[model samples]
Target: MSTDGASVHFSELVNRNRRTLARLEGSRSLLLRRRDGEDLVLTTASRAEQDRTVVSAATRMLLAMARREPGSMELLLDLLPDAFPWVRFLPETDLHAFAVELVDTMRAADSVGNNASVAQLLVEWQHTAEVHSDPELLAALTTDHGEDYGPVPDPREVA
Candidate 1:
């Protein structure tokens, strides 16, 4: 695949969160689908033989950095050219643009933290952006469409 093109033949995007011992940080997930739309999760970071598969650069970069640099993360642009899935949110990007727009978005997020839609939209955008990179996850995300599975117990109440 051409590394410096406006498009990639195989594309997926995802958004997810990571759960640590006591903290949950923003993260992403992606999955691929066969021609018939059968979900196939692209084996990725920490998995054996992942390099031979087509995984999202975002997922790889995040996992790689997390190993030695706990708080460091490269933006989507920092990882590769615009053809990758995570760059979908960059509506008007150029060669000179900074990678991983999270910074700017974070700044804007801080500015509008009081607005519910602003924060939610940004989270959803980032999530989809991350998920879109893998086919299986993308297929699952698209198929789910925010359905109501059931109600959840209140965490604040003691049984």
Candidate 2:
């Protein structure tokens, strides 16, 4: 029943459900691997709730530390390059901005018990750094094309 780190194929859930359920007894969760879709984590309701609580607390503590101790923000800024090597491509000012936005987004996402936004934010910032790393792309993006475009459409309407 100790199936930590073991992955169960998606079909196993239907064909060998008892075995999979048994595996969850020893471990807090199980990995469900799928061929045509994203993998999933299977865990008890209580365990999932516990994880959400822990993430929320950790994010809150990080934000509090960053605000209470000025040095904590500096420390996070210093560690960002190591955590995200692509961050090095960003200018110093942009790096600081990214860190601040990242921390805020993390806290917000944790509060909602959904980490998708955090992942999205990281991907977006990484792409930004990638763009900045290429001088031609950066210049192209910054260039002002004075040509008049039509009025912007409402996002809600587009949706």
Strongest candidate by lDDT = 2
lDDT of 2 by residue, 53-158 (tens): 8888888987887888768889888888888999999999999999899899998897777999998999999999999999999999999989869899999999
After superposition on all C-alphas, the RMSD of every candidate to the true structure, in Å, is: 18.9, 4.2
Candidate 1 residue-wise lDDT, 88-149, digit = tens: 54344421243334334444444443334445654665565666567788688669677797
Candidates' C-alpha lDDT: 0.42, 0.88
Runs in model 2 deviating more than 4 A are 1-4, 144-159
**Best-fitting candidate, measured by TM-score?**
2
What is the lDDT, from 0 to 100, of the residue 57 in candidate 1?
Answer: 42
Model 1 lDDT at residue 138: 69
Number of clashes recorded per candidate:
20, 0
After superposition, the stretches of candidate 1 with alpha carbons farther than 4 Å from their true spots are 1-85, 88-127, 145-147
Q: How close to the true structure is residue 145 of candidate 1, measured as C-alpha lDDT?
A: 77
